[model samples]
Target: MSHLPTLNTDTIWAILNEEIDDKIVNQLVWHYLGYRYNESKQIWDTSAVAEEWREKYPEPPDFIANRPPTVQLTRSIPKENKQLLKEYLGFKGYKIGEFGPRQTRRATMANWLLSYLKEKQMLA
Candidate 1:
């Protein structure tokens, strides 16, 4: 009887730039480390077993059992493609979020932005 609200690429892009905020990032890190979000507390509650696994493994899961290899955000994407993506997003009034100590994942952002632009035909 419940329905999930429909969301468009514009909304998703906005959420990516706006709603995935610092507090949310911390929550995501905690959840990725295996804690569940506590709605009332607005925090993630860590489990002992999750903490143990994290201590043992320390790194995030690199692959899914039956899925393609993860996208390499660290690899350098071509500068021309990168600039095209930025120009498209800027034309559409979308601002990219700055992340990380070294800002290494801009390639992934570029990919998403360009795909959205192409989908919306804001880019030729």
Candidate 2:
């Protein structure tokens, strides 16, 4: 089983200060459930076309055989939330692009929310 990350508000400050990587921020704040980095569903074994290719060439070239698996994200935030967060980040003088993508924006929003809750003593 994959493990969920433990997160904290300092992660946000690190992102804002450019001390932390955007990928890390995304992983910590927005990775969808059951997602582990570089883990993805494979089509080579299931696709009819791929199976046909295997029958024609039993031994694939090294490049094809050793190709790294890629990950397809299930997505981080809902569309409605993305729009709201985009507008909010823009209002705060941030370029949404700076956050990396949907997942990164979700991280930023999460950091902001955590900070807010902390300030209000709502989080321990």
Candidate 3:
């Protein structure tokens, strides 16, 4: 009854896929699995390796659980800004398709906008 939303393994995996480097994803997954396995064994030894793993892969924020279960961070963009961004990207010849498959265009745009906004200090 903690009232905190629970995040399952799949959700964690998806978030990790978006936010982390692919090279380290498998290592983190194996480390997490090992931690869970040791936890299940009930000996509960806090080994240095386990501590290191926790330091590297801290728990996701409680807010993440409350938000919609999507990799993209939710934010409202003004219609004018959206149009301006589209025009800007077009002018710069940065085609979304050039970056990746068609399905990923929205994610690509969201990430680009997030970076833009952060650089302008509009988002912290």
Against the true structure, whose TM-score is highest? Answer: 2
What is the alpha-carbon lDDT for the whole of candidate 2?
A: 0.38
Q: In candidate 1, residue 9 scores what lDDT?
A: 41
Local distance difference test values of all predictions, in order: 0.38, 0.38, 0.34
How many clashes show up per model? 0, 0, 0
Candidate 3 lDDT tens digits, 1-120? 122112233323343235533323323323322332244564433343344434543432122222321222223344445443335432232355564332243333333343344445
TM-score of each: 0.29, 0.31, 0.24
Candidate 2 residue-wise lDDT, 1-124, digit = tens = 1343344545444555566554554444323221233336532232322443345433222211122111111122343443332354333534656644443444444544454444455544
Model 2, residue 42: displacement in angstroms? 7.0
Error of 1 at 83 (Å): 2.6
Worst 10-residue lDDT window for candidate 2 reads: 64-73
**TM-score of candidate 3 relative to the true fold:** 0.24
Inter-residue clash pairs, candidate 1: none
TM-score of 1: 0.29
Error of 1 at 62 (Å): 7.0
Tell me which residue pairs clash in candidate 3: none
